[model samples]
Target: MKSSGSSFYDRIYRLVGMIPPGRVATYGQIARLAGRCSPRNVGYAMSSVPPDSPVPWHRVINSRGRISVRSDGEPCDAQRQMLRSEGIEFGPGGTVDLSVFGWRGPAGEVSNDEQW
Candidate 1:
């Protein structure tokens, strides 16, 4: 089935929520999972997360294991703090260790049927 209209963002947010805490996933990975081509779209989806969302938006990062942040705001620091509280380690070079904390989501199933 082809997803379109307003549901696309909702679908992306649901996928983002599926990402467990204390682990991270790249934008490309999320895009692929969402059956989308552009990782930037995944980033865009994340950036549009609603104020009342329960999704773990902080768990998504760039392919290079760096947080994708807005150039001018406190949101960047908030993301870093949230990740740190989750015990996700960051290097002195300002990179997340995806090898250690990368999340592949659920192992055996691929469905929107699961809880968000």
Candidate 2:
């Protein structure tokens, strides 16, 4: 059987690959989708993917709709620039408007909240 690490990375990459140029997904969202991984694990996979990866690591943000800075103090300006180039505008506080750009999978809205 394939190792969980390999499978986890593969699954994370697959979902990340689906994020369109101007859209974004959260590490938490990706972790939930990948099932067995955590947000930290998703972050690790994002950082570990090969340089030529088609996963679009720049598109994965935090649940607050802001890009999470790298652990090495590497600023996310390049990622913000890349998103801007794709027509994704950021607010004054550097947060994306999730209501407008969030991709909630095939079913649309991705939440388990009850309609009370």
Candidate 3:
């Protein structure tokens, strides 16, 4: 599906919202949840998140559980801080350990409401 407007973006946002605190999901995971074919679409949807939006955009990371962007400026630092505050551990190389902190979808069977 083509995510061309606010409704499409809203769907992506709502999916992101389902991600629990301290657990991170990959962009591909979000895309799959949103019924999107490409992970790039998930990134695009996140980039368009409004300033006042409550979606947990920071909880969405790459497949390897790494932040898409390195910690550089205030925003990046803030993102890292937020994750850390959630008890997400980072390796010595500043990479999150996916095996430990990554979310593997919902437990057991997928719920009908969770289906994209």
Candidate 4:
């Protein structure tokens, strides 16, 4: 059988796959959807995703509505460009407008009033 870590990573991938173009989900949101993983675990799993993986890993952002930078310097900036290409607009602070673009996955819609 696969290790539990593998299982958790697979679940995170599946959840991340559901995020459509122009929309995003946060580290905490993906963690809750993946059952046993925490937000930090989600980040770890994401970091391990291969560059060529079919998963749209770029759609995952922080709860503050900003992209999580890679281990490299701030110049590893493709995530923001990808989101913008899909018409997801960022505001004055370089934060995506999560209320307008957050993808809540299949369970239901996340209310626009959510503090995030």
Q: What TM-score do all the candidates reach, one by one?
A: 0.81, 0.81, 0.79, 0.82
Number of clashing pairs per prediction, in order: 0, 0, 0, 0
Whose TM-score is higher: candidate 1's or candidate 4's?
A: 4
lDDT of 2 by residue, 11-80 (tens): 8997888777778888988898888658999989998989887889888988898888888776579999
lDDT of 3 by residue, 48-92 (tens): 888898999999888877787733422477788899999999888
- Count clashing residue pairs in model 3: 0
* Clash pairs (backbone) in predicted model 1: none
The residue ranges of model 4 lying beyond 4 angstroms of the native Cα positions read 1-5, 108-116
Better of 2 and 3 by lDDT: 2
**True-vs-predicted CA distance for residue 54, candidate 4, Å:** 0.7
Candidate 4 lDDT over 1-116, as tens digits, reads 43536667888987887777878999998999888657999999999998776799889999999888877746237788889999899898689888999986755544465321
| Model 2 spans with C-alpha error above 4 angstroms | 1-5, 106-116
Q: Model 3 misses residue 90 by how many Å?
A: 0.4
Q: Per-model C-alpha lDDT, please?
A: 0.80, 0.81, 0.79, 0.82
Error of 1 at 69 (Å): 1.7
| TM-score-superior candidate, 1 or 3 | 1
How would you encode candidate 1's per-residue C-alpha lDDT over 1-116 as one tens digit per residue?
Answer: 43435666777787777777788889888888788878888888887888898888888988888888665643487888899999998998668999898886665345657644
